[model samples]
Target: MNEQTVTRDERAGEEAADPNRLLPDEDPSSHDPDDARHWLEVYDELLDFKRKMLTIAEEALDGMRDKPARREVVDTDRRVLRAECDRFEKRLAFWRNRLAAARDGKGP
Candidate 1:
């Protein structure tokens, strides 16, 4: 499956598994303070995970470059990791904005 398809499938599974999954347009004010805090914590964890993945991918790419036989594998892995990082970055941005709006009393 393509990256977009995989991302959608993953999101669907996550939402199914955790009904509290946050969406981009979620109104943070609708949730209690504790719930909003929990969501922020989750976002932090996911962001950290993506950062670590990006680091590992970069390291692997660097190491694999020395082994000509693994060029394709390295490239594929890098692409996947980068895509995951990008996805997480976008999610984090959305959550941050939502949190800010809620804090500013501009959220619904």
Candidate 2:
């Protein structure tokens, strides 16, 4: 989204409702629309993966009550995914702040 351009605020409860943007991002690529597009694609991929992980974890935990090893594996993998989600959320805030600053004439 460009600072000079108008951003939709009517349904702007979330970035998805704003037509001017896709998933928030950082890096020099933030200036390119494709960067945001690619970020969203990757985000969707990760989202789907996370859902699958949950289903797999549930299925694994439901089976083999005597097996405690699956819990360890599932917990570890879930933590990794959680860390990635946290990272992405922070990155999103970074990008959003950048946009706000730019719009306010406080950013390069």
lDDT of each: 0.63, 0.54
lDDT string, candidate 2, 1-108, tens digits: 664344454234344323234343435445444554455456556656766775676677667475567667566655555555555555555555555655666744
Which segments of candidate 1 are over 4 A away from where they belong?
1-36, 66-69
Tens-place lDDT digits, model 1, residues 1-108? 899999998886555344345556556455344455666677678768867876876666666655864676565555555555565566566666766777787755
Among residues 3 or more apart in sequence or in different chains, the pairs in candidate 1 whose N, CA or C atoms overlap within 3 Å are none
TM-score of predicted structure 2: 0.47
Q: Check candidate 2 and list the clashing pairs.
A: none
* Global Cα RMSD, each model: 7.0, 15.4
Task: After superposing candidate 2 on the true structure, give the runs of residues whose Cα lies further than 4 Å from its correct spot.
Answer: 1-29, 88-108
